[model samples]
Target: AGDIKAGRAKATQCAACHGIDGMSKLPEAPNLAGQTEEYLVKALNDFRTGERKNEMMTMMAKTLTDADVANLAAYYHSLGKQ
Candidate 1:
């Protein structure tokens, strides 16, 4: 398991879209809490690299380093679906 403290800190930018606990209020946004780490990492990489295209997500993911991806994935996985 990764460090929750580091994950939380890294997730600060994500709160606006994903919510503080990973439950997104936006119908279009997927709830990431409890999602598999593999999925989260892949999705983020896709967005960052332009394989996936969401303006906001691309912008956000673009700024995340590999460690940030791991930490955020850990935090969301810990939340576990809602």
Candidate 2:
């Protein structure tokens, strides 16, 4: 498991859309608190590569490095659903 502290810092930007607890209040946004790491990584990659077509997600994913993805995935996985 990665450091939660580190993950929190990286997750700051994510909170705007995802919420602090990983639950998105928006209808279209999916709750990510308890998602699998593999799924999170795939989604991030999809956004980054344009395989998925959400403008905001694509822009957000572009800001993340591989380590950022791993750390965020670990953090979200730790939440175990909300």
Q: For model 1, what is the C-alpha lDDT against the true structure?
A: 0.87
Worst 10-residue stretch by lDDT in candidate 1? 1-10
TM-scores of the candidates are 0.90, 0.88
Alpha carbon deviation, residue 16, candidate 1 (Å): 1.3
TM-score of 2: 0.88
Backbone clashes in candidate 2 total 0
Clashing pairs in 1: 33-81, 34-80
- Residue 57 Cα positional deviation in candidate 1, in Å, after optimal superposition: 0.3
- Checking candidate 2 for backbone clashes, the offending pairs are none
Q: What does candidate 1's lDDT look like per residue over 1-82, in tens digits?
A: 5566798898888888788799996988899889998899899989988999998998999999888888888889989844
